[model samples]
Target: MNQLKVELIVDNRVNRSTLSGNGIRNAVSLQPVLYVGGIPNNNHINLTGSGLNAYGFQGCLSSFIVDGRLLDYQRALVLN
Candidate 1:
């Protein structure tokens, strides 16, 4: 009983996010994007930390789907 589901759908100018856990579902719509990025070739991306992830997010994601593709999340990364 320790599972949570989060879904974010971006359409046009609005962003809709839904969170469901513990048999309850909640949804919200906002204008700001859920994911933020820096301008291309600009050096002031993370000005607070000098190009570093100073205000980034690090969390545990068991699995996620992108463009109908399912990804199994893990801590360790392998390069081939």
Candidate 2:
């Protein structure tokens, strides 16, 4: 299967309610959802980039979602 490398940046203080506890591991935890695609095996997805600022908090995030899902992710990443 073809694997894609995904990257993200998010506010650090934004409560990651969707992805907490065990869900934090091996998951590309997005705010409203978690996207898993392609082969659907436990593959490693790396997310790296600068941090974001909202209110008084700094946000940092990086991960992999399906191809089109980036639209929503980018919205959250920028307009926090």
Winner by lDDT: 2
- Give lDDT for model 2: 0.38
Residue-level lDDT of model 2, residues 19-78, one tens digit each, is 233333444435454433332246444332212211232343364334555345667558
Which candidate leads the pack in TM-score? 1
Compared to the true structure, candidate 1 yields what TM-score? 0.28
Task: Provide the lowest-lDDT 10-residue window in model 1.
Answer: 25-34
Where in model 1 is the C-alpha error above 4 Å?
Answer: 1-54, 74-76
Cα displacement (angstroms), candidate 2, residue 26, comes to: 24
Per-residue lDDT value at 25 in model 2: 42
**TM-score versus the correct structure, for each prediction:** 0.28, 0.16
Model 2: pairs clashing at backbone N, Cα or C within 3 Å:
10-59, 11-59, 12-58, 12-59
TM-score of 2: 0.16
